[model samples]
Target: MDKKINIYKDVEALSEGFTSLLKEELSKREIVNVSLSGGSTPKALFNYWVANCKESIDWNRIAFFWGDERCVRPTDEMSNFGMTKSLLFDKIPTIDKKKIHRIHGENESKEEVQWYTSIMDKYLPKENGLPVFDIMMLGMGDDGHTVSIFPHQIDLWNAEADCVTAQHPETGMERISLTGRLVNNSRNIVFLVTGKNKAEKVKQIIEEREKFADIYPAAKVNPVNGKLFWMLDEGAASLL
Candidate 1:
């Protein structure tokens, strides 16, 4: 795996760096397809974009997708898509409604997975029979989980489908997530991780890979034909 680690002094700096990176990517491509993750970590990035770059970027050419979402109504605070809409999408009026491809988290888990999979197949660019997202912004949990692929349910990482239904290890709440197969096909994969609580797991997954590969679900994210970047705040990179 060709992995690159970038550590920022704080969350604000990390958010700015990510925003700049996204802006650069969007400028380079006429149409950029990005899959976003939901977490406390990305909330700052969303806000930063709204405040600084919202008007400068060409919103119409950028299509939004999600990496995973909890099975909840769009109005629910727990909904990933809801958080994103409130923070980012709602602020960008120029973004076309058709470009915002959200998972119907209220639908049945398996049925939602199938619905999302078909959407991906129809819209995403395919390379080697797999959808290749232009950019995939992901966040890692303290448990070394990425997206909805928790450590206890690591088997879901290798699922053959582009998307699958996942159950949270502790809560058993249903989630629809993009499989590792689809994530690995991305053109660029960025892990935006923050907080001191995630320090050890981040160190284990990035530095001590061989030791934690079997246990850390985040370690399984190795882009076959794209660059993998770890954008961390000082708190998250302390153990590294």
Candidate 2:
């Protein structure tokens, strides 16, 4: 994996930098397939995009997908699709509806997993017999998990299926997540992380790799034949 670390002053600066990267990337191709992450920081990014770049961006040229989504109705507050829909999609009414491919959280976990897997296989470009997204965005939990692969269920990272059914460690809520193999196959994988609470795990993943391996799922995000980027704020990069 070719990796780069970008530390910003705060979430505000991080969002701005991410917006620039997104624009530069979208300009590189006619249709860019980007997998999204759900979280407060991403919420910030959406708001920034809406407030600053909505009119400037060529929304139709991008296809949107999610990295993971909780098993809940699209209207549910816990739903990743719901949050993204409200924050981004709702504001961009002209965006082509056919380009928005979401994992239906309302369906059964196993069923939705198969549904999303087929969607990826149909839409994403393939290389080495695996789906290859143009860009994959991920978030890191304080517990060092990325996507829905919690530390306790780390083996799911290598599940043969490109997408799998996952359960939250404590809540036990069902979720659909792209397995590590799928995420690692992307052309560009970026981790957008912030907050002081994540400093320890960030330190462990970046500086104490030998001791941290096999423990944190976030530490396992290595892009095969691709580039990896860490877009962090000062708080998350403090320990580094």
Per-residue lDDT of candidate 2, residues 1-240 (tens digit):
598899999888998887777788887888989999888999999888888887888999889999999999999999988998999999987678899999999998888888899999999889879999988999999999999899999999989999988899999988889999988998889899999999999988977765776999889888889899899999999989
TM-score of each: 0.97, 0.97
Residue-level lDDT tens digits of model 1 in 22-141: 788887888899999999978888888888887878889999999999999999999999999999889889888899999999998888898999999999989878988998999998
- For model 2, where is the 10-residue window of minimal lDDT? 204-213
Q: After superposition, how far is residue 213 of candidate 1 from its true place, in Å?
A: 1.7
Q: What TM-score does model 2 achieve against the real structure?
A: 0.97
Off by over 4 Å in 2: none
Give the lDDT of residue 224 in candidate 1.
88
Q: Which stretches of candidate 1 lie over 4 Å from their true place?
A: none
